[model samples]
Target: MTVTRFAPSPTGYLHVGNLRSALFNWLIARKAGGTFILRLDDTDPERSKEEYVDGIREDLEWLGLTWDREERQSARLDRYADAADQLREMGRFYEAWETPTELDLKRKKLLNMGRPPVYDRAALALSDDEKAALRRNRGTGVWRFKLDQERIEWTDGILGDVSIDAASVSDPVLIRQDGQVLYTLASVVDDTDMGVTDVVRGADHVTNTATQVQMIRALGGHVPDFAHHSLLTGPTGEALSKRLGTLALRDLRARGIEPMAILSLMARIGSADPVELRGSHDELIEGFDISRFGSAPTKFDVEDLVPITASVVHGLDALDVDEALSRAGVPDRLRKPYWSVVRGNTATRAEAGAWWPVFSGHATPEIAEEDREFVVKAFEMLGDPPYADDAWSDWTNAVKAETGRKGRGLFMPLRLAVTGQARGPEMADVMPLLQKKPSFD
Candidate 1:
């Protein structure tokens, strides 16, 4: 069975980009009857927080991306240590003693010679005593994985037929000088030990996947099939990385973007499929096909979500929003009809509150300067008491005959004067719910 995991660092809340990565892995697992693991790459304990861990869980739960198992890198320090020792024993891990300034100078020297600024691996030349002497001077050396100088290739699920020259890439540091096991080493150990069989992540991690693929084999673990999905951009194709902080799932939730709307759009935004609002998580999983996605950065527009949200709201059962209508002062007799009337006018459930006051208690009329006379005539025609379902049509038609008005000029003033807006649920439906008759006064 295919197994996948979404490994996120608990340093911050999740954004839409993060959602795409998480959902891709989740859909693969769900579609294959496999396990979905939530691995927290919280190796840097200094920056990771419990609140962020909670936030990550909250965001995933909000999106319905439930995980079967959760693994934290902080809890697996000994596992990483053992892997590091095994690599050192196999001559695949080596100590490197180079300060940032020294490495920068080496890079500049290599660039001056019209060469690639890859690591020269000078520390590999040092003998044991020389290394001890250097370590004694610099406290401790960082651990770097010694990559085989060859081409690394894998058939990526999305990008397909990927190859990288290891010699051109600098050896990744696996363990920092301060004894912190970096992501490069910790991820390999966890993914291998946890039986992660399929890896789906952002395009930015394609090079990282090549390095991890080698590490996994070095540790005698099966190499999982990998896919690198394209990154996201703004609606106009501007880089979205700078603005993702503001687009956190929590922020979007606060902005009233429904979870299903977000899930539906994310499941298809970069794919060949068009973005269609789905009714449930099962629908998203049933239709998910990673092969349909492309490597081009997909353009995402937050405003486009408005209509999808309206669509979601339009398909809800009266029971789904029964309590909300109760809280908003809709009478038991009026809740069903009230929801039917307002759902189309609303892009989100929050907008339902705006429609309540138009009928339940009070509404301020919005008559334009030129149409005030027409509105006054219409208001007087709407006499108090014994109003029916056809009261708006009856009053408007009578006013239309009396004032020689028709079309928008015939209807807009009446709509604005009564509901305080030019558009809403059919005024016929809005009229019966009105506890008080509207007037120009």
Candidate 2:
């Protein structure tokens, strides 16, 4: 059986960049009839919050991306400690003491000498007495996983045949001096112990994956299949890292972006497949193929969601929008046809609240100065109350016949006088639903 995990730190609300990794893992697991785990990387208890964890769950639920089980790094401290001890016993873990400024100077010196700016294992050169003295002065030092100094390679599920020289890369810091386990260590331990078979994440983590692959092998764990999807950028291809804070899933939902609209576009934005609005989770699952995706940075436009959301709106049945229509003050009797009439004109059901006034509220016509005379004449011809499907045509025809006005001159003013707008659903369907009869003075 296949297994996958979407491990996120509960330090902030989920943004679109985060969802790309999450949805990929979820869809892969679902398509394989596998188990998908939602792991919380809350090792940094100081920054993690219960509210953020709740928000993550709420966001996933809203997207219909359900997880089978959840695991928290905080709860698995003993397991990580055991793994750390085992690595130490295997001589693959060592203590390192270096301040931030010391590391920066070392990096600059290495670059000046035209060498890879990797850790020089200075800690490994320290004598036993010197190490004891330094530990006493600086307290505990951070733990670094010693690398094999060879080429680490893997056939990536998406990028294909990735290779990294371990000699050129710094030994990863696994545990801080404060005893907090970082993502690299905790993820390797959890993924190994939890039986996660596949790992999918952003391209930025490809180097991390290369390092974690070595860590997994050292601990006698199966190295899962890895795929690094490209990162998202702005519509104009600007780096989205700075703008992701504003694209939180909650914000999009508040703006009335349909879940399907988001899911549909996200699933295909950088893939070879063209994005098509899927009506349900199953349809999304059926068409999800990670192999069809490329490694290029995907350009995402929030504006793209509007028409897709409108497409979703146009497909909804009456029951799907009944409560919305009712809330819009459409009498229960008329909601059926009311939605049918206005559905195409809306991008989301939330817009129905604004449209309700056109039928139920006073007709405040913004008649252009030039058309005021024709509009007043047209309103005079409109009969009082209880309109029908033929009311607009009948009224416009009568006005056209009496005033010698035709085409735009005759039709434009009547529509503005009656509905207060020039563009919307068919006037024929909008006429009978109007309860506030048009008034002329």
Candidate 3:
């Protein structure tokens, strides 16, 4: 059976970048009829908060990304400690004492000589007496995983064949001097222990995956299949890292982007398939193929979600928007009628409120300066609202005859005069819903 996990740190709200990983892993697991784990990498108790954990769960629930079980790294600290001891016994983990200043100077010197700034393993040469003295002066030393100097290669699910020279990369720090286990160590331990079969994450983690492959082998564990999907960029191909605050899942939800619209776009934005709005998660799951995705940075624009959202809103059942319609002061009798009349015009369910005021005669008309007189004349010929079902046709016919206007010239101005907008549901459908007469006075 296949197993996958999405490990997110509850330090902040889940953003779009985080969503991609969660979605990919979820699809892979569900598609295989396997288990999906929601692992919280809350090793850093200082930054991680309970509120953020609740927020993460809420966001995933909103997106319909349900997980089978949840795991917290904080609860598995002993497992990480055991793995650290195992690596130490095998001579694969060593203590390193170097301040930030000393490491920066070493890196600068290496770059000046046209060499990679890999760690020189100076700690390996220190004898017991010297190591004791350094530890006494520097406090607790950070634990680093000593990588074997060789080429590490794997066939990535998305990026195809990959290779990295272990000698050129610095040995990863797995445990801090403050006695906190970092993600690098905790993730490997959890993945191995939980029987995870696949790992999917962002393209930025390709190097991390290369190192982790070695770590998994060092611990006598089976390496899962790894894939690195492309990162998202702004509309014009700019980095989205700086503007992530506005791209958070909560922000997008507040902006009225439907869950299906977001999921539909995200599931295929970087893939070979064209993005098509899916009405249900089942449809999205049925169509998902991880192999179809490319490695290039995918361009994402918030504006692209508008049309999709409009389509989603257009197809929404009355029950789906019941609360929103009720809040808009739409009475029980007019809820279905009002939704039907304005559903096409609305890009979001919240936008249905704008039409209630228009229908109830509370909206001010938006006639242009040149068209104001024409609108006043039309209102005179049409009289007050409380219109009949055919009132729009009867009134438009009267105005068209008096002004020698037909087609857009006559209909466009009247729509603006009555609805306060140039476009809306057919005036015929809107006429009977009007509870009060529209007046330009």
Across 1-441, the per-residue lDDT of candidate 2 in tens digits comes to: 899999999999999999989999999999999999999999998999999999999999999999999999899999999999999999999999998889999999999999989999999999999889989999899999999999999999899999999998999999999999999999999989988899999999998999999999999999999999999999999999999888999999999899999999999999999999998999999999988989999999888988999899889887788777777777888777778888888878787655777888565776888888877777767776679789988987888888999988777777887778898888988888888677745
Looking at model 2, residue 58 earns an lDDT score of 99
Better of 2 and 3 by TM-score: 2
Write candidate 3's Cα lDDT for 1-441 as tens digits: 899999999999999988999999999999999999999999998999999999999999999999999999999999999999999999999999999899999999999999999999999999999999998999989999999989999999999999999999999999999999999999999999999999999999998998999999999899999999999999999999998988889999999999999999999999999999998999999999999999999999989999999999999877788888888888998898888888888889777677888888887888889888888888778656577889989989989899888998889988887888877789999988988878776
For each candidate in turn, the TM-score is 0.96, 0.98, 0.97
Clashes by residue pair, model 2: none
Cα-based lDDT at residue 156, candidate 2: 91
lDDT of 1 by residue, 281-321 (tens): 88999999999999999999888777887798888866777
Those runs of model 1 whose alpha carbons end farther than 4 Å from true positions after fitting are none
Full ranking by TM-score: 2, 3, 1
Candidate 1 residue pairs in backbone clash: none
Candidate 3 vs. truth: CA RMSD?
A: 1.4
Best candidate according to lDDT: 3
Question: What is the overall TM-score of model 3 with all chains considered together?
Answer: 0.97
